[model samples]
Every structure is written in C-alpha cells, then in structure tokens.
Target: MKLVVRVKLLPTPLQAAALEATLHACNEAATWAASVAFENETRRPLELRKHTYAEIRERWGLGAQAAQHAIKKTCDAYTTLKANLRNGRYGRPSSRRHARASGKPVVFRPQAAQPYDDRMLSWQHQAHTVSIWTTAGRLKGVAFTGQAEQLEVLAAHRKGESDLLFRDGKWFLIATCEIPEGDLNTHPDGFLGVDLGIVNIAATSDGERHSGRRINRKREQDRKLRSKLQKKNTKSAKRRAKKHAGKEARRNKDINHKISRRIVAEAERTGRGIALETLTGIRERARLRKPQRTTLHSWPFAQLGSFIAYKAKKAGVPVVYVDPAYTSQECSQCHHTARGNRPSQAVFACRVCGFVDHADHNASHNIRQRGWMVWVCGAQSTAPELNLIA
Candidate 1:
C-alpha cells in the first residue's frame, strides 16, 4: 500500500517568492492546456490534427522550451476533460485560460524525467541542493525539527513519484511509500454484529451504540456562525467564513477517524469479523428523506466503512458488508415483516411475534445473520440472511 504523508514546507523569504511564482506558472499552464484541448476538438472539422509543440509555442507567444515544459506538466492526463466538455465545460476551466488565440496548442504530457533548467537557484532544507542529469542522489533530510520543513529544488530531477494536489489555496504533496502485505488470517477475532443508521450513526449488536454528536453539534455551530457572519460586512466575516468552514471540515474528519478507530479496535480486540451495511444508493435514499436530509447526509457512513475495511485488511480481520434491505423493518428473531416492528425512529417492536427490542439492536442481529450466511455459503450468499449454517 502507498501512504502519503504531507510534511510542512518552510521556505526562506526569497524561496517563498519563487515557489509562489512556480505555482502560478503551473496553474496558468493547466488553464492554457484546457483551452488548447477545447480548441483541438473544435478544430477537428477543419481536418486539423493535434498541434505540434513548435506550433503551440508560437501561437501562445511562450518560449519554445518553457511552453513545452508546461504542456508536459499539465494537459495530457485528463481524457474526459476535453472530450466531456462541449464548447466549454460549465465552470471556468481555470482562471488562466487564453481564449484570444486560434488553431490548437499541444496537449500537455509529463515526461518520465523532470523538465527544468539547470543552475536554477534552490536551497534544500538544511541539506545541500545537488543537481545531476536524469537521476540525482539525495541524502535524506532530518525529520521533525519543529521548524517548517521545506525543500527547494533549483531545476532538479525527481524520481517521478510525487503527486501534488492544489485545494483551498494550499498545495499538498502525496509521497508514496510501500507497505508490506500480510496474511489475512494472521490473527483471529470473534464475530461483531453491526447496525447502521442515519440518526444514531451506528450500534453494535452487543448493545454498544455510537452517537452522531459530531454532526449535530457542527450544524448548530455552523448555524450560529453563519447567522453572525450574515449580519456583518467586513473582512473579518470573510476570514471567518473561510476559517470556520475549514475548521468544520477538519473537525468532521477528526470525528470520523475516531469513530473508525473505535470500531476497528473493537473488532481487533474481539478477534472477529465485522458486519456492516452495504450502503448502496444511500446518498440517493438520503435525498428522499427531505425533512431529515441534512442529518441523514451528514452521517459519514462511507468514510467510516472505508476506515474499517482498510484497518481490517491490515490486521487480517475479515469484513462483511451485509445487505441493508429491510434490516429495520424485519424482525431479527423470526424474520417476519411488519409495519409495526419499527414504528418510529428509536422504537422496534415486532408485531407478528411481539419481539420487543432496540431498533438498532434488531438490525444488528440481521447484519450478523447476513455475515454468517456469507461464511457458510461463500459466493452464493446474496445478503445478510443465509440460513444454512445457522
């Protein structure tokens, strides 16, 4: 598995200017490339083939080498970008597209080697900035010095591995690292029955339920903040809008991590496979619940499920995604369907056999049954309730 860790990059005063310039340049290149792609598609009727690199440079009034380099860094990867768009895609392709030119610019494609000028100025973080052709040697820098961790490459070549993401006015570099694959049955755990819900988040068949306190509190907090911001007309309010939204997102992420960790740890301790819902069409279904749509959608079911799955994979624990159909309405003990079994959000009482139970607990039992059926029937198990083994 590849794990990406974002290390803080602290650049010197001069270095910061250069970094910002480079980022702008890259963004411009991306924007230009998008425009070029659209033009290429439009020009197809004129029997024009893709523009050559030389033609692109002259048309864009960019330096031969620089323009070529930008194309390499930007355009070639987005297959859907040019093709999916007609005339232009709805939103601004980028804030930097140039529409004044004709014909088409060459599509950008990254070469295996880093394309930049040598003798460019860069100061690596406390380490020597060494440049060599194609492949260069690097002595790894010291880790975690409390100071901002930064590396400046003056036209240096890299191993073609780093992925950069620009979002919310910041750039994140994802460096891939390999992790060893281990035995699936390396450690054994007992079974865990799970129940999924929008209101409560989820509950274990063992009577342990987790609250959706994070989302509830977030909505209330956002409501108050939005109300306050709406009343103001100043920079502080704008700053608050940006800052609070980011804070809210981070807070939500932290909560998800905690929830995932809890579930995974519980499964590990019990040494059992986890039973979760196959939340297919959940997003669509959430939309149908108009009144409580916010609450239903706010639940990070996908994130939690992902965490559980990956953790289970690493720890050799099995995970079963049981079918969620009728989990709440069907009686767990008798498998009898009734309108009165789950008459309300919290209450679950079976009308057919009078099996009174917590709604979540009843659903969890069915989830477990689904898993058992899978283990017994292998690939033939369609959902959470195969009965041959039980």
Candidate 2:
C-alpha cells in the first residue's frame, strides 16, 4: 500500500529564505510556461518544454532538474484542469462557470508545493536532517521532525517524490512510502460492523460509540466565527480566517486516525473482518433541513471508512462493504422493517417483537449480519427478511 508520511521542516532563517525564493522562481516560470502552452495549445510536457525550457533556465536560474520539474508540473496542472472540465466539475458547458474556467490559463500559487526527486533531495534519517536543492544553492543539514512511527516508515519504506509545501507560515515535506501489506486473512471468525452517522460518527457491532458531538460542536463554533469574520471583512479578520482555514479538517483527521486504529486493532485481535456501508452518492440521496444540511455535508463518514479499510488491509484483516439500504429502519432482532421501528434519531424499537436497542447499535447489528451473509452465502443479503431463512 502507498502511504504519505508528512514531517514538519524546521529551517534556519537563511534556509527559509532560500526555500521561499526557489518556490517563487519555480512558480513564476511555471506561470509563464502555462501562458505559452495556452497560446500554443500545447499540452504535452515535451512539446511545452521545447518552447519554454531554455528561457526557464536562463531567466529563473534553476538547475536542469528543477527546470524540468517546473515544466512538467505546469503540464500536469493543465492535464488535471482538462480532466475536471471533461467531468463537468464546473457544471455544463453552457454555464458561465464552465466558460470562465475553460477560457483562462491555469496559474500557479507562489508558494505552491514543488516535487523533489531523489537527485534533488537527500534524507539523513539518523540525524533527522535533509540536504535539498534551492534556487540560492543546495541547502544542507535542514532539520525535520515527525512522529516516531512516521519516522520509522520514512526510513524503511519511503520512496518516490517528496513535495515541499509552505502553508500558514510553516514548511512541510510529504514523503510517499510503499509499505508491504500483510498476508490476507482468508478465514475470518466474524465481522466488526461499523455504522456511520452524524451524531455518533461511528458505532461498531461491539457496542462502541465514537461520538462526534465534540466534533460537531467545534465545527459549529468555527462556522460561527468564520461567518462573523466574513461579515467584518477586515484585514485582521481575514488573517484570522486564513489561520483557521484547515483547523477543523486537521482535528477531524486526527480523530478519524485514532478511531480507525482502535477499530482495526480490536478486529485483528478477535480475528474479525471489518464491514462498512457502500455509501456512494449519499450526499445526493440524503435530504435534510437548512441548518442540518451543513452538518450532513461536513460529516467525514467516507474518510473514516477509508481509514478503517487501509489500516485493516495492512494488518491482514478482511474488509467487506454491504448495502446500507433500510439498515437504519429494519429491526435487527425480528427482521421486521417499518418506519415505526425508529421512533426517534437515537432509539430503535421493533414493533413486531417488542425488542429495543440503540438506533445506531441495531443498525450495526444488521450490518454485521448482512456482511456475514454476503461473505458466507455470496449474496447481497440487504433486504430485511433475508436473514429470517434457515
């Protein structure tokens, strides 16, 4: 599996200045290359380089490798933009959004991340330092720090290009690591069902509730603050908003990591496979009130599912995706399906057999049973009455 390990780079003032200058020169050269490509209708890196390479080297004072990377980066950006246009990401071709997006040449941010090949960057794992190429010159002994596990992975399995990015006045290097997966667990004892929801982010069949209350509260607070800042629209307010831009996302990602780690650990310990809902197109299918829309949209259910999957795979734990249709409305005990089974958001009461349980808990039980049926019988087993048969 391919994983990205990010480490913070701690550089001296001189090193930082050199890094900043390198990024600015590279991006400026890329911008000029993009303009040339746009005018000449050139999308291939080689063809675009034919037009801009010599000038980039002479004007930007970049080394041969850096010049090639900048040109390639510009071409990559255009390719991505073309793909987005084809996918209708900017809406229909007749729409103003599409027209505006398609009519302009792509521009690069001054401090946008630049990829570094092995020739351009060298790691000193034991010393926790790096020697990297910069526009001013080659920088040596630049320090970096990360978690112990990340450092271990970086030393043992890191490969491919590393991206140097400047964000919120901090420098970071994201290194790719190719970690080997463990042997697959062909025989699993059971399935650990995980039900995802807005209130409780994840509820497992083992009756563990990873609540999202705190997360939701914090998101709400951030939203309110953001609204106030936008209304004020002052320089200081904009600065504060920019500072808080990714705070919620970072916090959510951390929580998801912890939750996924625990879930995978428990399933591996008990020799159980992980079961998740196939929630594709959930955003379009879901309908909510005005205020609740933000909550639903902001929920990171997919992120949590992905985290569980990758961690499970690394540990040789099997994973299955089951149809989520009617899982919340169906009774886990009696297999009865009705709207009345779920009288409220949190409670599940079976009308047929008078069995009661937590709504999310019952849903997870249904998911677990469905996952088992799908695994053993080779059927979807999503219908409420499918489990009633011998």
Candidate 3:
C-alpha cells in the first residue's frame, strides 16, 4: 500500500524566495506547455516533451529535471481533465460547464505544486533537514518538521517523487511512502457491520456509535460565520475568510481518523472483518430538502469509509461492501422489508413482527447478515468442489 507523508518545510528568507521563484517559473512553463499540447492535440508526455522540452529549459532557466517534471505535470493535468469529462463530472457535452472546460487550454496556478525526484531533492532524516533544488541554486540544510511517526515512515519507506506545494502561506512536501501489507485474515469469526450516517457518523452492529452532533454544530456555526463574511465583502473580511478556509475540513478529517482507528482496532482484536455500505452514486441518488441538502452533501461519509478500509488493510483485517438498498427499512429480527419499518428518524419498528430497535443498529445487523452471505458465496465460488456439492 502507498501512503503519503506530508512534512512542513522551514526555509530561510533567501531559500523561500528561491523556492517561490522556482514554483512560479515551473507553473508558467506548464501553462505554456498545456497550450501547446491543446493546439497540437498531443497529450502524451513523451511526445509532448519533444515539442516543449528545449523551450521550457531555455525560457524558464529551469534545470533539466525541473523542466521534465513541469511538462509531465501539464500532461497529467490534461489527462485528469479528460477523465473528468468522460465521467460527466461537468455534466453533458451540451452543458455550458462542459463546453467551457473542453474549449480552452488548461491553466496552472502561480503557486502550483511541482514534483521533485531524487536528483532534484534529497533528505537528511537524522539531521531533520533537506537539500532541494531551486531556481536560484541548490538549497542545502533546509529544515523540515513533522509528526514523529510520519518522520519515521518517511525515513524508512519514502520513495518516488515528492511534490513541493505552497498552501496557506506555508511550505510543505508531500512524500509518497510505499509500505508493504501483511498477510490478510481470510477466515474471519464474523463481520462487524458499520452503518454510516450524517447524524451518528458511524454505527456498528456491536452497538458502538461515534456521534457527529458536536461536529455538525461547529460546521453550522462556521457556515453562518462564512455567510456573514461574504456579505461584508471587505478586504479584511476576505483575508479572514481565506485564513479560516479548510479549518472545518481538517477537523472533520482528524475526527474521521480517530473513529476509523478505533473501529479497525476493535475488528482486529475480535478477528472480525469490516463490512461497509457500497455508497457509489449516493450523492446523485439521494433526495433531500434545501436545509438537509447542505448537510448531506457536506458529510464525509466516503472519507470515513476509506479511512476504515485502509486502516483495516494495514491490520490484516478483511473488508467487504454490502448493498445498502433497504437495510434501514428491513426488520433485522423478522426479515420484513417495508418503508413503515422506520417509523422515525432513529427508531426502527417492524410492521409485521412489532419488533423495535435503533434504526442504524438494525440496519447494521442486516448489513452483517448480507456480508456473511456474500463471503460464503464467494468462498464457495472459489472452491469448485464445494460449489458442485451445493
């Protein structure tokens, strides 16, 4: 499995200036390269390099490695754009958003991230410093800091290109670390089904709930404050808004990390596999009122699921995705499915059996049952002899 370890870079004023210049130059070169690629209908990095390599090196005064990376990044941007278009992320081809996206060459931000390979960047883990290439010259002994665990991981497993990015008036490097996975737990005792929701955040079949009430309140407050700032529309207000940007996202991500860690640890301890809902196309499929729409759209259900998945992987615990279509409506006790099963937001009352339970808890049990069936079927399919007997 590949993980990213991001560390904050501390540089002298001179070093910062050089880095700033280098980033700007690389992005400028990339923007020009994109235009050339668009005009010639050439997006392949190798073929596009033939047209823009010499010019970028000479015009931007960038080193050979820097020039190559800039061109590659440009091609990568176009590739991503093309994929988005194919996926209809911008809507139909007749839509204005789609037309606007496909009509022009891609542009790079002034402080866009630039990739640095071994030749362009080297780290001194023990010394807590890095020697990186800059347009001015090669910078040596530039300090960097990160969490102790992350620093250790970077030192041990860091490989491939690192991206230097400037964000929120800070310099950072995102390094890719390729960590080997351990043996997977194929034979599990049972599946720990987890139900993801906007209110509860995550509810497991084991009756554990990680509440999101406090976080949702904070988000509402932030939204209100942001609305006021936008209405004010002053320079200072704008500055403050920019300063606070991503704060909510960071908080949500941290909370998700803690919740996922606990869930994975519990599953590993019990020798249980994790079962989650297959939430693909949820956004498009969901319908909600105006007020509820924001809450639903802003919810980080996918991030939580992904975190649980990767953490479970690292712990050698297996994970399965179950179809969640009527899990909330189906009675876990009687297997009766109907819209009336959920008499309230949080309560599940079966119409036929008169059995009652927490809505999420009942749903999780249904998910657990489905997960077990899927696992059994899959196991049988893998063994043809067992399949023939069945």
Candidate 4:
C-alpha cells in the first residue's frame, strides 16, 4: 500500500528564491517540450522521447535529474491526454488543437509544484532537514517538520520520489511512503453495511449515522460568501474568498478522514467486513433539479469511500461493493422494490409488509444483504432473500 505524507518545509530566503527559480525554469522547459511533442506530425513516445532531457538541461540551466523529471512530467501529461482520447473519456485531442490555436500561446502554468527524484531529494532524519537540488546548486539544510508518525513513515518506507509544492506562501514536501499490505480478515461474523448519501454522509446497518448537516451548512455559507465576494469585484476580496474556499475544502477533507477512520475502526473492532454501494457515474445519471445539483455534486461520496477502502486495507479488513440499483427503494424487511416504498426523504415504509424504518438505514441493510449474496451466492444470484450463515 502507498500513502502520501505531507510535511512543511522551512527554507531560508535564499533557498526559497532559488527553489522558485528552479520551478519556473522547469515549468518553462516542460511547456516547451509539451508544445513540441504535440505539434509533431507523428505523436509517438519514441518521437517524443527523442527531444531528450539533455536539451532541457542545457537550455534551462537545471540539474540533470531535475531536467529529466520536467521532461517526464511533460510526456506524462501528453500520454494522459492521448489515453483519455483513446478511452473516450474525453472528446478529440485538445493538446493538438491548443497547440494550433491562435492566442498568446498556451503554456503550462508555473504553479510552483515540482517533482523530485531520489537523486534530487534526500532527507536527514536526525536533523529534521531535507536537501533538494536547485538550479543555483544543491540547497542543503532546508528544515521540515511533521507529526512523529508521519516522520516515522518517511524514515522507514519513503521511496521513489516526492513532490515539492508551494502553497499559501509555504513550502511543503509530499512524501510517498510504501507500506506492506497485511493479510485480509475475510472470515468475518457479518458485514457492516454503509449507505452514502447527501444529507447524511454515511449510515451504517448497525444504526450509526454520520450526518452531513453541518457540512452542508458550511458549504452553503461558503457559497454565499463567495458570491458576495465576487460581486465586490476587488482583488483583495477575491484573494480572501479564495483563502476561505481553500479553508472550507480542508475542513471538509478532515471531516471525511475522521468519519472514514471511525467507520473502518468499527468494522475492525466488530470483526466484520465493510460493505459499500458502487456509485460510479452517479452524478451524471442523477438528473437532479437545478437547485439540488450543487448540493449533490458537493457531496464527497467518492472521497469518503476511498478513505474507507484504504484505511480498511491497512487494518486487514475486507471491503466489498454491492450494486447500488434499487438499494434505496428496496425494503430490507419485506423485499419489496418500488419508488413509493420511500414516501419521504427520511421515511421508508413497505406497503406490502407494513415494515417501516429510516430510509438510509433501510438502504444500508439492503446493501449489506446484497453484498453477502454477491460474495457467497456469486454475483449472478438475483435472490435478495437468500439465506446466509452468520
């Protein structure tokens, strides 16, 4: 398993300026490479790689490894664009069009984020400092601070490369740490079903609910603030608004992290596998009304699910995804499926069997049952009421 740990970097003024210059030069070189790669009549890796890092190194005055990383980044961007076009994930090749488009000449923005390989980046565990190669030369003794646990991961399993990012006037090193995967605990007593939604972030089959009310309220507040700031049409107001937006995102991300941790911990403690609903392309298919579209799109269902999955993997807990079709409308008690089964957003009532429960909770139960059926009876099984051993 691979995870990224971000640590703050404290650099002297000189080091900071040099780092900024190096990032700018690297980005410029990358833009040049990307334009050349896309404008070429034949778009092959062999033709692209022919451009070479030595050319960028000589032109940009960058370290050999830094130059190589910059060219690789350009190639990666082009490759992704090509792949997306091939997979139909996107329409047409935008890079070619952009390269030929008339304007100020489209170029990659120098966002002050650069990738550093092992040769360009090194950490000093005892001194709590990092040495990174810069255009001016190698800058040593750039201090960094992080949590003890994060530092431990960096010291023990940090590998390959790390990203140097400049954000909000601060420098950060995002280290990728590779952790060993543990044997999954598959023979569980039961499954902990989780239904993810907009109003409630998650509802467990065990009757525990993690509400999204507060998160929704905060999002609304931020939206209104942004609107008012945009109306002002002032630079300072726009800057402040951007800052608030970032803060709101960080807060929501932290909440998701906490909620996922709790959910995974509960499954681990109870010796149960976690079951979640498959929600691929849910937003595109939802066909929500204009007013509700923003709210639905803002829900962090994907982020929450990913967090739960990675955390569960680290804990050796099995996580499964059940088909989401009719999970909300299907009755957990009576097995009746109908749109009218859920008369209200929060109420679930089965007309045939007179079984009633919280709408989300009922959906969670159905999800758990479906997961069991999928796992035990095989995915082809359509009997939702099949008997299973606990």
Task: Give a tens-digit lDDT track for model 3, residues 98-133.
Answer: 999999999999999999999999999999999999
Whole-model lDDT values for every prediction: 0.55, 0.88, 0.87, 0.79
Q: lDDT for model 4, please.
A: 0.79
What's the TM-score of every candidate structure? 0.69, 0.91, 0.96, 0.90
Among all candidates shown, the one with the greatest TM-score: 3
Q: Would you list the rank order by lDDT, best first? A: 2, 3, 4, 1
Query: Candidate 2 — what's its lDDT?
Result: 0.88
Stretch of 10 with least lDDT, candidate 2 = 381-390
lDDT of 2 by residue, 157-213 (tens): 888889999999999999888778877777889899999888898899999999988
Worst 10 residues of 3 by lDDT: 381-390
> By TM-score, is 1 or 4 better?
4
Candidate 1 stretches greater than 4 Å from native: 42-77, 80-160, 165-171, 186-190, 227-233, 287-291, 379-390
lDDT of 1 at 172: 37
Candidate 1 has an lDDT of 0.55
Query: What stretches of model 3 exceed 4 Å from their correct place?
Result: 379-390
